[model samples]
Target: MNPKMSSPKVGFLYPGYAAEDDYPRLGKMVNPNVDVELIITEFNEDAHTVEALSEMGSNRRIVDGTKHLVGKGVQSVLWTSTSASFVRGLEGIKEQIATLEEQLNVPASTTALAFVRAAKAIGAKRVALAATYPEDVALLFKVLLESFDIEVIQFASKGIITAAEVGTLQKDEVGNLAVENDCPDADALFIPDTALHSAEWIEDLEEAVQKPVLTANQVSFWEALRLTGQFTPQKGLGTLFKQELPKEGELDVIKS
Candidate 1:
């Protein structure tokens, strides 16, 4: 409600069981003027499959959460879960966004789509995945990225099923994971998990791996700002914010 603290609010409908402890850390790294607020919804930490994620994602909790955030003066909404959106596939995820926008009258997006867009922005044709989800869940993400023409050169399932557990990782540990899992042919390394906090050390991770490292939480924030036309190149979040994207989603250094 404090006008000074809250301008350009970005609403995130985050999963319930998964802790969004990282958003605050990343918010501090962004423009202090923008407000990043999260509304938690139902999620099954034990259910790491597509069916489970889809069912949970289909529940009205997303719409309910969006409404709650909009009341808090958020101008945009992002369903901040990768599995939930991709489990439903491309069309289903787009439908989710449509429904969110129709109900809230604000531009909306999901973590899966955000990853795709983020990768495209950097011209990442082949990426390596460092996922906290199981292999099955990670494969679903792979399919989703492939839908956007992004190839997963390598993917490693950390086998960390619960979001609560992934939330326990420190920034250094997260950065090590990004660097360790990066494959030779990958143009970028992707660490997707709202539960995992990567923004705290994304810049360092990029330097360690010698490649762009994208995280779900980071892109979720970036995509939200872009959706609201409030995206600016900021420090600490990662390389994604350090560059600009052309009209075709290619970075200036890359020609499509």
Candidate 2:
């Protein structure tokens, strides 16, 4: 890391208010040297339906939403909603990142892509998913993971329809979901939903399952650091943060 780059500022184009607090808390916990800025994107509805998610992640919406971060000096920007990004599939996410880079002039990625990279970083070839979306939406994430050659050994869907409702789940509820859905044979347990709070529960959740726990907000923040080349091993955040990313050509599934 560059000497001046010790304190890097990362921007996030988040969808709504659900669990957005995780960013600042993460910045503080990782090291006092990082800055996390967020610009909440506009959306017609918070529902997890395909139509709603498509609108939320549309190129126009993402580009327009990220305009505020242009002059903020953010080293990298991330689309922080997992469901919205994955709903568009791999090609659509590539377009989203391209548009954001064109508009913001910085490295860009999404939470959906972040999960794949984070998993690969930790050598998690097989993972179990515990999603807050309905079965249909949850399956899309499975397909997204499989595209990167990562297997989804077990799947659990909560059938929750809105991000607002998911935001209300307490720590115990979130932890229970992860612990219950974890597969013993899997390398890690993945909880997909930016709305849910898992940043503070990473250690406990990992202890509960005796395996790595990858959560949306947690991986999204870690991905931002990876993009800026500022990743340093951090303790208590779970296995993903402790692992080193593969060299440039090793896992270049989606180029930053």
Which candidate has the highest lDDT of all?
Answer: 2
- Candidate 2 — worst ten consecutive residues by lDDT sum? 247-256
Cα deviation in Å at residue 214, candidate 1?
0.4
After superposition, candidate 1 runs with Cα above 4 Å error: 1-6, 44-46, 248-256
- lDDT for position 58 in model 2: 94
TM-score of 2: 0.96
List, residue by residue over 1-256, the lDDT tens digit for candidate 1: 2334345777888887555866656666776556778778875544667777887688476777766765676788899888888888878887888878877888788888888888878779999999988898899889888867798899898887677788888877887787778998999999988888776687788888988889888899888877776666777766788886547434222121
TM-score on alpha carbons, each prediction: 0.89, 0.96
For model 1 the TM-score comes to: 0.89
Segments of candidate 2 deviating more than 4 angstroms: 1-5
After superposition on all C-alphas, the RMSD of every candidate to the true structure, in Å, is 4.1, 1.4
lDDT of 2 by residue, 29-140 (tens): 8864579888899988989988999999998889788878879999999999999999999998999889989998999889999999888888999999999999999999
Q: For every model in order, what is the number of clashing pairs?
A: 0, 0
